[model samples]
Target: MKVEIWSDVMCPFCYIGKHNFEKALENLPFKNEVEVEWKSFQLDPTLNPSETKTTVEYFKEKKGIPEAQASQMVSQVAQMGQMAEIDFNFEKALITNTFPAHRLIHLAKKHNLSSEVEEALFEAHFIDGENVGSIDLLVSIAEKLGIDKEEAQKVLNSDTFDQEVNQDIADAQNNGITGVPFFVLNGKYAVSGAQPVETFVNALQQTYNETVSPFKDLSDGGTSCDADGCSI
Candidate 1:
């Protein structure tokens, strides 16, 4: 089974959802048969890379929420993160564009380090409060993943993977995806948001068991004849 996840690195729920999904996979009988592909999505694509503001301030400015309300919102999300054992420091988070980070993720995909890059980006932004839009920071993260720094830097410095990133966003739009942490299982089942671990497990098992047909029969018995006799 293949699972495609559309996520934005800066999205707090994406991190939480990833951990929940990981827990689900761990408990699944067919875990070894599952393939996970990370797709890019930008929550704020128009945000300037050079902008210097805390995430709370950005929310206040962009969403028209008061600073106190934004802080409360952040606190609520942080409490949710605690459920996933993720330490989210929203106050430290920097408001910046994620396009560069997404492009680096695309580059990392070719080298089979996309997952690592994604985790590192989430940690950098949410935990370490690093500027994800910085080419230097992205290159450093790639280097930590054992990717060639020069090659990674070259990709970041150029327009490489720009279309790949855009294509991922385009595909998300075509799929009617309106949020992050959206998961598609076997290209058939779509699970939106940071669903609970049990929910993901059920979805995985249900999709895996749907081999014979997409439509399921809930009736206990049908009017089928056996070799011995016909059933009522």
Candidate 2:
């Protein structure tokens, strides 16, 4: 079974979903047979490098919420992260444009270090409060991961893997994805949001047990309305 996830580094739910999915896989019987792919999705594409706002400030401005409410909300998210064994230092967390980080992730995928890079980016952003959008920080992290520092620096300094990251974003858009932590199972079934571990395990089991039938028409053939239009 192959599972692809579209998520952003700054997305708290993505980290939570990652943890839940890992727990689910750990308990699955065919965990060794499953392959996972992490796709890129940017929550804020127009973010500028000069923006020095904290996550709390960004949320307050974006959602039009008061600073106090935003702080409380972040605190709640921090507590939830703690429960999942993720240390989220919202106090020092900086709001950054994740496009560069996504590009590095694509490059890491080519070297079979995508998972390591993803985890490192998440930890840098949420736990260590490091600016993952910075090339210097990314190169440092890549070096720490045993990847050739000069090669990684060269990739970051140039436009390498930028197209791949853009393609991933385009693919996510084509799939009608509007949020992070979206999971696609076997390129057929999709589940959105940070669901519980049991839910993910059940979905994994269902996908594993079902056989792909080329001649069978398994489509639900339902119609739905959205902001774009109504479609079947």
Candidate 3:
């Protein structure tokens, strides 16, 4: 089975969903047969790359909500994060454009380091309060994943994977996806948002079992044995 996840680096729930989905995969017997791909999405595509503001402030301004409401929203998300055992420091999160980060993720995909950088990017943005839009930060994350620094820098410095990043976003739109942490299984089954681990495991198991057909019975009643008795 193949799973494609649409996520934004700065999306708090994406981090939680990623961990939950991975935990689900770990419970499957055919986990090794599953292919995981990280697709890009931008939560705030129009935000300036150099903009500096706390997540709460940005949320208040963007959503036109009051300060108290915005703080409450962040608190609720933080509570959800705690349920997933994720440490989210949204108080210091900066609202910056994630285009560069998404482009770098595409670049990392070439080296099979996309997943590694995705986790690192989320950690930097949500927990460590690092500006994810920084090319330097992204390149450093890629380097830590064993990706070539020059290649990563080159990609970040130029529009190398811009098209790829846009393509992922376009694909998400084509799939009617309007949110992050969206999971598509084998291009067929879809699970949205930060669903629980058991939900993901059930989806994975069902999709795996569906590889074979379970046709409806069409003939006269067939004889079958049950735990209670045998049909004759």
Best by lDDT: 1
lDDT of 2 by residue, 55-152 (tens): 89999989999999999999999888877888889888888889888878887887888888988998898888888888899999888988888988
lDDT tens digits, residues 188-231, model 3?
A: 89999999999999999988877554365579888899999998
TM-scores for every candidate against the unseen true structure: 0.91, 0.88, 0.91
Residue range 125-221, candidate 1, lDDT tens digits:
9999999999999999999899999999999999899999999999999999989999999999999999999999999999888843667888987
Model 3 residue runs over 4 Å out of place are 212-232
Query: What's the ranking of the predictions by TM-score, best on top?
Result: 3, 1, 2
lDDT of 2 at 10: 90
